[model samples]
Target: AQRHSGAAMAEQGRQRMADDRCNAGGTAEHARPGDPLRQHREEEVGRERGLHGALRLRRRVALLGHLGLQHVLRPPAAPLLGQGPAGARAEVPPHAGRAAGNYPMATMVYFQCVFAAITLILLAGSLLGRMNIRAWMIFVPLWLTFSYTIGAFSLWGGGFLFQWGVMDYSGGYVIHLSSGIAGFTAAYWVGPRSTKDRERFPPNNVLLMLAGAGILWMGWAGFNGGDPYAANLDSSIAVLNTNICAATSLLVWTSLDVIFFKKPSVIGAVQGMITGLVCITPGAGLVQGWAAIVMGILSGSIPWFTMMVVHKRSKLLQRVDDTLGVFHTHAVAGFLGGVTTGLFAEPTLCSMFVPVTNSRGAFYGGSGGMQLLKQVVGALFIVGWNVVVTSIICLV
Candidate 1:
């Protein structure tokens, strides 16, 4: 009887694993119903990742409130809850409901939904205070359908870029670059905020903004770390690289502010932190700690120059009220990250993952040049697609 029961349990474990309902604690051997210790450990691992996601969601709330008080109060259902979630499924595995990687099918579905939600929220910041809520409500689904889905598929969902070996470790391109470009483009057609309002878009709540910024800084553990979809070495390195880049970027950005602006601005620090996070994301797990710091230094200074220097001179940028400077932070930082990944991605690290090819960074020379070219082409594809598609969506 005990033998039969053990066999049954093993069968159950195989079934669970086959469905991708994997636990963090162990493998098939730990699937016994009586293994409370392993089960507890599994729960702990899951709780950690879940909290990371929850923390991000909380931080996002703070950002929305800071970036757009009106949008914060408005409902997020603008995209039709049902519509977006369904599309997320398609983005992952169109042919099957099986688990895609280390996590469960349900978990994959959930995260995809969250990614979509966050992307929409990030894009909306550009149009805040100027566009009507009703128009936003209508715009969400249209943009998701026309702009986001295609981008997601082309990058993460095993489209040409994925096959061509463009590494995005996370959504530096698919989410940030695409949304930033789309947001800026849409903001163009939507028109700028009133001159008086544009001249002074004061924060509604500074304390909450700081609180949100702190949470956002912390939440990046999951933001970049969670891309590996595992609690292994890759995710650990990703978390480490993420923090290293962010801290370096923050300090650099703050120093630039002090040197040029005559004061260290809290907003400037937060912007720097975000750019660092975005900048390291594309190669978080694939690069060394030192590379992350190099990336951070560049991420901090480059975006600041563009937002502070270039924005003032660019007639097109000034004409379009990118209310939150999405172009500078997300689009520019994200594209920089992708290209940097091609320049820094380690071949040995890339060897661990079956999906990643062209792992050698340009810094290593040889085929690395090809990888960098691929990254540029991939980023350009996303930028072009968003600009064209977003304009069409906004026009309609």
Candidate 2:
């Protein structure tokens, strides 16, 4: 029994010693602070800091990228208190002054580019059926920069002319007038189509022309509706007024064709419809539906007469040989529209849509002071710019 008791005490002592050794090793490692859990925690902390640093760096880079892009893409800001070279104020309007970097303005700018594109396409009609594709590629961008951009910037981009209060309404002076004049000018430079083509002048495919007409008719909804920058009642009014003018012009033109030629030609009717659309563009948002009808009758008849009778008689005009009849379609129609707007502008409607307090046009109980002056200035500015720029582009 005594031996057994002694052996048991020895065994207990050995077990306690082994436990002490293990405890000592644990204590030593913790005291040195080299435990795996502690190292893992440190590593985790380091990884978190590195991730945070990376995120901050990325944010800074993004900010710099945005600033650089803004500088490149946005128009330079003009001084607010200075007078421009020609006595125009160097101030941005309220619409243009709002965050210039906003997406809405960018979208509007892109829309304007589309408008410029379509105008060029219309001009291309004169050069069609014969123009080399390579020449057209060069002409499109050149004319856009030289002719379209200046007119757009000057009239709509808050440049010198707009500050002086020239109301183009929806581009009677800026788009149609400039495109017409520049198209005719370029056609003069490019010269007329082949004499054989001139003699056999019917379109190869009237169906295509009719299709283009349909697209144009539907697209005018966007054309005029987009001018107001919103899908509001004014857009509706403009659309309604546009259709009225087109319908009235069509009927008038058809009647004239039957009376003059003893047959109503679809081609002649198409010309009248186009003139009506172009002539009413400037006045669509401001004039009543009835006024549009009156404007249309005059536009259809006068421009048709000018193209059919007056152009054939004039030696100076024959020398130019404006292939697509741009003079009558864009210039004459646009000018007539501008003049008609000055004559038929309804006071209430103009006051509502135009953000100004000028009197109605000469016929609508408004003073002629700002009206006639504004129209004349707008037209002259567009015409003068086109003459200079079209000359430069063609010559260069």
Off by over 4 Å in 2: 1-106
Q: What is the alpha-carbon lDDT of model 2 when measured against the actual structure?
A: 0.74
Q: Write the per-residue lDDT of candidate 1 for residues 1-396, one digit (tens) a residue.
A: 999997886566546543433444456554664455544443444454354455446546766776775454565453554656555633333222112366678998898888888889889889988888888998899888888898888878888888788888879998899889999999999998888999887878888989999999898898877776765567777899999999999999999999998999988999999999999988898899999999999999999999999999999988999999999999999999999998988887666542655468899887889889989999999999999988887887
Error of 2 at 159 (Å): 2.6
How many residue pairs collide in each prediction? 0, 0
After the best TM-score superposition of candidate 1, give how far the Cα of residue 196 lies from its true spot, in angstroms.
1.3
Residue 273's lDDT in candidate 2: 86
Give each model's whole-structure lDDT: 0.83, 0.74
Summarize candidate 2's per-residue lDDT along 1-396 as a digit string, tens digits. 999997886566545534544554643234333345433343443354444455445445656666675434344576687545323432323132112233476797788878887788767765666667887788788888868888887777787766665566678777788888887787778777778978788666888888888888888877876676755456667788888898788888888999999999888778888888899988887788889999999988998898989999998678776777888888889988888887778776666555446657777554755676677778888888888888777778
Show model 1 residue runs off by greater than 4 Å.
1-102, 354-358
List of clashing residue pairs for candidate 1: none
